[model samples]
Target: MASPARSLNPTPPLKGSFPLDHFGECKAFRIDYLKCLKERDGAQYECRDVAQRYLQCRMDAGLMEKEEMSKLGYTKSNSNRRRVSQDSYKKSKESKGFIAGLSK
Candidate 1:
């Protein structure tokens, strides 16, 4: 007797796709992390700050679920602290007339 034929359909992609950053809510931070990874020759540890910011932005914007974020090492308190530090850094740079690669 002949064996039953196997199904030939390909598996469907995930509902929304992986690497939620495609939603664009946190594209800038995602790009920064990508650039950092390239600069560091793919040393993920060297890009932790940028990675964290990208993850935090996705979480804040609801593009990614909190559980998923936590699974990837995100913490609410850590994000809050990083936000404050980033804000201060931007303020200091602005005071020095620096605006995203332009300085007077």
Candidate 2:
């Protein structure tokens, strides 16, 4: 028997603009961001978010200060994680308190 055909829809690559500062210390992070640009099957992942996360990691590691990050436009996430935490959040508000609780 023949195998099922796969969908032909291809994913597009994600691109990020240049660093907020060109000749500043944070420019190094820009290089690191591009180096780790998520690429697979000729498509790139959203670079900014990933880059910011990596930037945050650097900050936590004491390699970069929060001020430097802010100068480079890498502040805290403006998004609400809880809203996108699961597929059910989009389904209904009932999922608000709906959780699998612990047992005795």
Prediction RMSDs, each to the true structure? 14.7, 13.6
Which candidate has the top score in lDDT? 1
What lDDT would each prediction earn against the true structure?
A: 0.74, 0.52
Clashes per prediction? 0, 0
- In the predicted model 2, the residue pairs found to clash are none
CA deviation > 4 Å runs, candidate 1: 1-23, 67-71, 74-104
Error of 2 at 44 (Å): 8.0
Model 1 clash pairs are none
Cα lDDT of model 2 by residue, 7-103, tens digit = 8996554433223443354556656666666452212233556677667765555554554655666445533333245335545646454455742
On the 0 to 100 scale, the lDDT of residue 70 in model 1 is: 64
Predicted candidate 1 versus true structure: per-residue lDDT over 1-104, tens digit per residue: 99999999888665454555555888899889999999987866557778888877876887766546566766667667776787688688878775466655
TM-scores of the candidates are: 0.49, 0.29
Pick the TM-score winner: 1
